[model samples]
Target: GGIITQTPKFLIGQEGQKLTLKCQQNFNHDTMYWYRQDSGKGLRLIYYSITENDLQKGDLSEGYDASREKKSSFSLTVTSAQKNEMAVFLCASSIMGFNYAEQFFGPGTRLTVL
Candidate 1:
C-alpha cells in the first residue's frame, strides 16, 4: 500500500550545470533504483542500491551520481546538463522477494536543460 514520490516535479537547468533529483519511498524495501528515460527511448538504469548507503552504478551511470542516505530515500545527480536536454528520471523499489521481487516506480522528475 506504499508508494514512491519524486520531488520538484519539474526541473530546469543551464547547460553544463549539475542537477540533482530526489526520491522517497514508504514501502520499507531494501532495494532502490534510479532510471532515466529520454524522448522516444526506453528507460535506462542509472543507479541502484541493494541496501542503505550502498550504491551500485548502472550502465548509464557514467554521467550521474546517486546517494542512499537511508532506505526511505534515494537521490540522483546529473553530472553535466546538456544543452536543450530533456528526460525523465524515475525511482523504484523492490522488496527483494525470492527470485522475483516486484518493484514499484514513482511518477518521475522531469528535466529540461536550456
Candidate 2:
C-alpha cells in the first residue's frame, strides 16, 4: 500500500503573489500530475511530470510551474494568484504503461485569494 501527502491544507494569498504547494507519494509511480478545480468547473490539468527532472505543460500551465525533483515528489508554484479566483489544487499519480490507469488524488489544497 502507498500514500500521498500534500502540504498546506489551505493557502491564503494576495493577488499577484506567487504561492507554492508540495506533494509527496510513497507509491513510486512513474507519472505525477497537478490539477486545479474551480467552483462549478471540472478539474483542469496544470502540469505533469513523466519522470524525474521531466516537465510537461498541461492545459492550465500558463500560470503555474511544476517540478519533479525526485521520483517520489512533485511540487507546484502559482506564478501569480488571480484576483477573485479561488480553487482547489489536487495532486495525482499513476503508473506509466500502455494500459489505462486511474489517478489517485490527494486531499487537496484550497486556495483563497485576497
Candidate 3:
C-alpha cells in the first residue's frame, strides 16, 4: 500500500504550447497509466507503461506523449495544446496480474489552456 501525487495542482497552458504534467507514486507498482477526463465524458486512456521506459499508446494518445523514466514516476506531455481546452489528467499505478489489477490513483491535475 502506498500513495500517489501529481505536481502543479492546476496547469495553465497557451495555445499550441507543449505542457507537461508529472505524477509520482510510492507504490512501486509495475504498471502506470495516464488518463484524461473531460467535463462530461468518462476517462479516456492517454498512455500506459508496463515497465520503466516502455510506453504504450492509448485511445487518446494522438495529441499527447508519455514517459516512464523511473518506476516511481510517470509523465504526460500535451504535444500541442488547444485553445479553450480543459481536462483533468489522472495518474494511476497498479501491480498487474494476469486478469485483474487494482489501480490506485492520484488526486489529479487539472489543465486549462488559454
Candidate 4:
C-alpha cells in the first residue's frame, strides 16, 4: 500500500496574494495532477506532470504554476487569488502508460480568499 499527503488542509488568503500547495506520494506513479473544484462545479484540471522535471498546463492552468521536482512530489502555486473565491484543490496520481487510468486523490486543500 502507498500514501499521498497534502499539506495545510485549509487555507485562508487575501485577494491578490499568491498561495502555494504541496503534494507528495509514495506510490511511485509517473503522473501527477492538480485540479480545482468550485462550489457546485465539477473538477477542472489545473496542471499535470508526466514525469520529473516535466510540466503540462491544463485547461484551467491560466492562473497557476506547477512543478514536479522529483518523481514523488508535485507542487502548485496560485498566481493570484481572487476576492470572494473559494475552491478545493485536489492532487492526484496514477500509473504511467495509460491516459485513462484511474487516479487516486488526496484529502484536498480548501481555499478561501477574503
TM-score of 4: 0.96
Candidate 3 structure quality by residue, lDDT tens digits, 1-114: 699999888999999999999999998899999999998898999999998999999899999999899999999999999999999999999996235888899999999999
- Compose the digit string of candidate 1's lDDT tens values, residues 16-86: 99988999999999999999999889999899999989999889999899999988999999989999888
The residue ranges of model 4 lying beyond 4 angstroms of the native Cα positions read: none
lDDT of 2 by residue, 1-114 (tens): 898899899999999999999999998899999999998899999999889999999999998988898999999999999987789999999988235888888999999999
Summed backbone clashes in each candidate are 0, 0, 0, 0
State how far residue 40 of model 4 sits from its true place (Å).
1.6
Worst 10 residues of 1 by lDDT: 94-103
Better of 2 and 3 by lDDT: 3
User: lDDT of all the models against the reference?
Assistant: 0.92, 0.91, 0.92, 0.93
Q: Model 4, range 2-71, lDDT digits (tens) per residue?
A: 8889977999999999999999999999999999998888999999999999999899999899989999
The estimated TM-scores of all candidates read 0.95, 0.95, 0.96, 0.96
What residue runs in model 1 are displaced by over 4 Å at the alpha carbon?
97-99
